[model samples]
Target: MDRPALLAALRARVGRLERAGAAAALARSQAGVVHLSEDIDAHLPQGGLARAGLHEVLAAEPGAAAGFAAVILGRTGGPVLWIGPDPDAWPSGLVRYGLSPAELVLVRAPRPADGLWAMEEALRCAAVGGALLALSDIDLTAARRLQLAAEAGGALGLLLRPDTEEAGPSAALTRWRVDALAGSGGSAHSLGDPRWQLDLLRGRGSTPRSWTVAWRTTTDRLETEGGTLAAPTRNRRRA
Candidate 1:
């Protein structure tokens, strides 16, 4: 096999082994998974973001990452818990993304350790439909703890970390990076709908992929702007 193909195969094998334990657990929780767009779900092992699994979202742009994550939680039928150092997410901003403020539970943890603790507790709470932790960094151990917590609680755990953090190995079912994209001109009176380039850096039994999409308020859905690709350029973040 070619050098690139060989390396890719080896990497995929390693990822599978690293996540082997959680695979069976997540498989059993497929009924609790929340489906995204059919196209995006097609590439995910659980057919969508498994509600009882942990996922990572790189904070390439804080707003873009939060917006994307919010879009995911909007699909859920229950409350969301957000734990982080910042408590600046006001209701008005999230409403447009289809996430209601009333459904959110915000907890501010000034210290990193405190934030992790809060996230772990929230993830393991069955009452929480989703838990989002905004962190600057995380290790494989911490990621695994949160992953297992999500499994136990039947809630989705989302880690929003800075893009500068090395995209190392993790226990997350999927890692994503969302970057704000230039708006496509349409409404002269508006700045155009929010657009983002989404990179699925890695997934369980799924090849890395990229999609450009816009959150259309009128349609209340994330529409793929130019469709999707099996793999984006190497310049983009990958794990």
Candidate 2:
């Protein structure tokens, strides 16, 4: 083989080896960490939510996505800093979801830039257990900043983006798309547990997967079995 061709081949081989080494290292690191619940933990590469990482949550239905995030925040036992415009959470409603209104500090930013700033600052606060932000648009640079801040404080950062926004490149540790199911509610008069079709679109050192989960807000419990809708039966007219 020519000298130049031999050198190029060697470089390509080195590059491939480097990529494989990085993937293996990431997998080893993730296997030791487990966050959230058993169902989600089993699917995630990191086992559970990484305490010092950023997680992105998006859904076509805004309410469904918000509920999913709420469940995560509920698992944290410290104060939660929520930043956004016109948060949809009701003080009483949060109780059913395992969040205490007293433990929440809400910050309403007049603009998107201000909101992002608040989120980064909140995530950096050691006293804060988690930071939640509602954003319609975000770039790679901004997302990385949030991730770093969360790592510094060992807090979980949840970014809620609009479904209309495309799932482009992000520095977030995990990206999830939550869709609310029709059977989320119970009877005509009373609302029962909320259910969702949770899609894990992206994760570090993990494959994408989906699940149907039921959340009993009153008890803050997640049930994975017997929540799915039954197949519809086709009726045929008698001849």
lDDT of 1 at 233: 66
TM-score of model number 1: 0.83
TM-scores for every candidate against the unseen true structure: 0.83, 0.77
Cα RMSDs of all predictions? 12.5, 15.3
**List of clashing residue pairs for candidate 1:** none
Most accurate candidate by TM-score: 1
How good is model 2 by TM-score?
Answer: 0.77
> What do the candidate models score in CA lDDT, each in turn?
0.77, 0.70
Position 105, candidate 2: lDDT: 67
Candidate 1 Cα errors over 4 Å, as ranges = 1-30, 186-188
lDDT by residue for model 1 (1-239), tens: 44355346534533443354244334435557777777788878778777888999997888988999898877765567677888666668988888898778777777777778777866665555677898878888988988989878777889988887467888999889889887666566666789988989888888888898888877778888667787876586446
**Candidate 2 lDDT, 16-103, residue by residue in tens:** 5345445443443333342555777776665678776799988657877877787777666556767787666665666666778876
